[model samples]
Target: MKAWRLGWARGVVELRQSFSNGGDLVSHFLWPVLMLVALFFLRDREFAGTGILLGTLALPSILGMNAAMGMVSMSQQLTADREDGTLLRAKATPYGVQAYLVGKVVSVAGGLIADLVILFVPAMFLVDGLVFTPLSLLSLLGVLLLGLVATLPIGAILGSAFPSARAQGLVQLPVLAMIAISGIFYPLTALPGWVQVVAQFSPIYWLGLGTRSALLPDATVVVEAGESWRSVETVLVLGAWAVVGLLIAPVLLRRMARRESGSSVAVRREKALQRVG
Candidate 1:
């Protein structure tokens, strides 16, 4: 059918099945909640939602973590689709491939946003008096939109690159490491000069910076000249990365498509049987 109609149809199907993974959703959220609890109990004694900002750093940081986690999880789903021959089969139909692709990205993005709600709403009460100002809310939304745009395609590329299902599980460690080095949980100033330099090259760096900017109103206190902590030029960099990521993801998909062997399932099954015998 038509591309638009196909997009809609595929979106529905993808969301239906992808969202059906309720256990994965629970898994995605469980650890973060515990972390939040620790922050509330441990960090709270040290830092109150003092000053004008209430839930600024904590909420945004939580959002940033969700974005990172969501990207890796989304990638694994794509890799699974490939390994199971699901994506290859869908690609054979007119507009089916495009629809499925759109659906995959959209569902993942939606789920990530939903996760933000889950974390923030509960934390409003659970994490002590975390308040939101108009400007702070706008800033949070800005960072979130930019992050969604920037992260979705990167996840797609990684999913395509590491099509092995096992690879998906281990990939988050490196991603979390990038996040740590990117100064999401701590100040970049505390990290070594070389480590900071390495973190500067990461997408999460731009994301963290942008999110922090949204939360920290007093620009001088939050960030200043020559420091990579402020939104500064990271907004432009994030925008550039978003465009590049979306464009490159399709190209990567096309290249992977060329590698399909076009073998029947029967042949693969027979080969498996022969090997077993």
Candidate 2:
């Protein structure tokens, strides 16, 4: 109990540090803005904004960036700590490992939630000249929450998969690939058949589908929506993803810890020391 509370405290500290570092906020808003701007110019032509498609497309991009940041940042940062012996020292104690992991989730996920809200404001404003019902607002919130729940566990698992931060870049390739696979920029209709098949296995597509349903009009065409824009299946899939992610993360993390090495710790420590010196 005390350990969990302490973890929350540590998580809060990380959240603050994440916010203080402006990189996330910029990336979160910038890419989406560029996409929106490009769409704006395209809207002047007959090819874009013909219907609800834009909202559906944009929702996924926001959720994807949020999910990406949480997973990649948390994984790399905590793994860095692990390779540096921070988590190893905790592991020597009874509940230290649990505390650290809890704290990490709290910190990373909390920042992600804030970033989602920040994106929400622009989503409303950016999708202007369109009708937004009360139902739309509720759906948007639902999608955001569902996406958060679903994406965090993926982050935790990835973070714990590698032995150190040096391997983080490699471990994170899947996440980067997810952006392209999930059809954030182009429609999934345009992707090759195999790529689309691979996307179904990634959480990114589910998030994009969910968010698009929440924000886009009922009549808009979605790549995944064979019949309807707001398929109950999207919510179900996202919920399933979230549950599985949460369940699997702890086990994978434990496995990563078991694989930690002494030399790895020493090398990481030396790196941190070099940075400080």
lDDT by residue for model 2 (1-277), tens: 9889878988899778766768856755675566566555433232144443444455545565565557676777777788668888877777778888888888777866776666556655654433467986677667767777777777777777766566887866767788767767666666788888898677677767666666555555544536455457777877888889888988888887776667768877788678679
RMSD value for candidate 1 = 4.1
Worst 10 residues of 1 by lDDT: 46-55
* lDDT scores in order: 0.68, 0.68
Residue 176 alpha-carbon offset, candidate 1, angstroms: 1.7
Output the worst ten-in-a-row residue range by lDDT, candidate 2.
42-51
lDDT for model 2 comes to 0.68
Give TM per candidate.
0.81, 0.80
Candidate 2: where is the Cα deviation over 4 Å?
21-56, 92-94, 129-131, 222-224, 258-264, 270-277
In terms of TM-score, which candidate is strongest?
1
Clashes of each: 0, 1
Clash pairs detected, candidate 1: none
Candidate 1 lDDT, 1-277, residue by residue in tens: 4766776666667556655798766765787677676557544442223332323444556667677566786688887777667777877887767777777777787767767787777666654433368977887788788888888888888887874666776778888789778766555656788997898787877776666666554532333226435465777887888899989998997776666445633444455567669
